[model samples]
Target chain A: MGDIQAIAKQFTDFYYSTFDSNRSALQAVYRPTSMLTWEGSPILGATDITEKLVSLPFEKVQHKVTTFDAQPSSPTIASILVSVTGLLLVDDSPNPLQFSQIFHLIPDAGSYYVYNDVFRLNYG
Target chain B: MGDIQAIAKQFTDFYYSTFDSNRSALQAVYRPTSMLTWEGSPILGATDITEKLVSLPFEKVQHKVTTFDAQPSSPTIASILVSVTGLLLVDDSPNPLQFSQIFHLIPDAGSYYVYNDVFRLNYG
Candidate 1:
């Protein structure tokens, strides 16, 4: 249970910290098989998603996690609910957005890794 | 795409309506194979979830869906984002709660059915 919480925290932390700039930290959390489907159309795997993020002009973004729900179905499988409010620096303008992220976590090589993540973007 | 939106709306409507008192309506949306995970420990299937819901004393509830995002991944598969605010009458006390529900839709026979649904309850 504790381990799952830690893993869940790690995921949100990585999302807030690395989603905008830190490439290495982002790489650390996502498995090679990881895939993201955004707005229901674009289906991109780990490498593509990372490339897309890196190519963007987002200089800084801060995520405030309002609620974090973690459930460990098994010792190796965990689910997380991460609700966030983000302050994005878009063209030097502050764009505030609310988002909810769901993560499916799995243990790999004795360490927990994010298997898949689905997110919904909300406008403020 | 339109079909998925309609199905997603049906889901929210059913949840807001039957989750309180209408047992038959509750049975309509959920399949026998459906299962729900609340908090972390409990794993109850459709029948058990319905029974538990029926035992509650909730008289009336109204759900306002703020944002409904639906994406048809394929002709037979779809995804939805349903963010809702509910007014619940609990012992004659008004309880307002914000919740976000995600639904994965699949076509069964000739109609669409929810494969899995995950929700997060937010207290205001």
Candidate 2:
């Protein structure tokens, strides 16, 4: 349980920092079978997903995580279900958009990669 | 892939409806090891989690799903990752709050159950 929390914290910190600094670098976290749903549009594979992310309208972006929760998915499958709520600033925008994201991370060779990812902007 | 979408839709619809109408009925979808993080607080197991859900401050609540995304977690594990964004109405309040939730559904004996759930309010 402590290990789960620690990895969750470390993963979130690394994820957001990498996203803010270099969007393309996120490809390391995905695989060929990975799927990413960005604003309801599904993108498959690591390269295509990374391209979709890099093609977003914003040149600069920052994510401030408000809260996150992580849990082991199944007893048989070695995976982590992580959910995050955050505020996002894009392209130097003064107003930050509240967002929600979920990442299904699967174990690889001594590491983890995103198997499923979903991102949404929570707007009223 | 198509089955994943259909199941995701059915699950979310049934979930929020059951949540609004009869919160206790949700226990069927949870197991002993299931975990729910509601508003950043972790609730473990079906009975305790259902109790926590039923004990929320509001007597009446409704969830209006804005968008949802789903993906299969792994080729070996028969599970789906479902993420949802929605507007939430508590009681008779006119101002609705936006919320984001993720559900990790794992297949059981000819059925599916909630293995992990995370809920967060997207407040600015």
Candidate 3:
């Protein structure tokens, strides 16, 4: 069996390191064929997902990974939770919006990468 | 150290045992002084939280715990994620709501229980 803790740590580290405008790092942690579904709509693959993340209309948005959880499957497939707080750049906007996101990750070659992710925005 | 996998299992088992009208089981897994914060407001202890969950204006509601993760702390403290899908019973209502909940849990004696849980409803 794989080291579930180590895999979980790696997953969270990669997730936090690429949050916000870190497009290059984001590219590294996600599989090329990765898909992100937001609000129940399929948003295509990693490149498109990256583009969508970067294209959000924010002057200085910030993403903070608040918590991470993972369950190891085999040596490759793992389920992960990458909770986040996204701070909008709009001056009059409220504080960071809280989101709890789940990612199904798979190890590719020597590196671990996200395979599928879904974000749920918290609003009571 | 406690078996992380076992701990994770126990936590999730307790979480899903009473997702809908099963108030008795819900009352079991949570700490007596547990606090649940919906959105940003503090909702007091487990009794209050259970009351709120049961009082939802739905004819038939169901809660399903999709995934679980835990990091053990000492013999008492652990961080848990109880990802969920909540189905509303209202006519013409949406299928189910997706939520990723992060929980701070503590083991009392031998049983694991949730201490603090925050739910983030995923819309987008």
lDDT for B40 (candidate 3): 41
Candidate with best lDDT = 2
Task: Give each model a TM-score.
Answer: 0.59, 0.96, 0.48
DockQ of each: 0.16, 0.88, 0.09
Model number with the top DockQ = 2
Q: Model 3: runs farther than 4 Å from truth?
A: A74-94, B1-18, B22-124
Docking class of 1: incorrect
Candidate ranking under DockQ, highest first, comes to 2, 1, 3
- Residue pairs of candidate 1 with colliding backbone atoms: none
Residue-level lDDT tens digits of model 1 in A16-70? 7676557545666666666554544344456776675566556665566666655
lDDT of 3 by residue, A10-121 (tens): 6665665556446545766665667675644456567888777666666555556554444332222344333443322333467667555666555557656666566655
Estimate every model's Cα lDDT from 0 to 1.
Answer: 0.54, 0.89, 0.55
- Candidate 1 ranges with C-alpha deviation above 4 Å: A20-24, A73-95, B1-17, B20-59, B62-98, B103-118, B121-124
Q: How many pairs of residues collide in each model?
A: 0, 0, 2
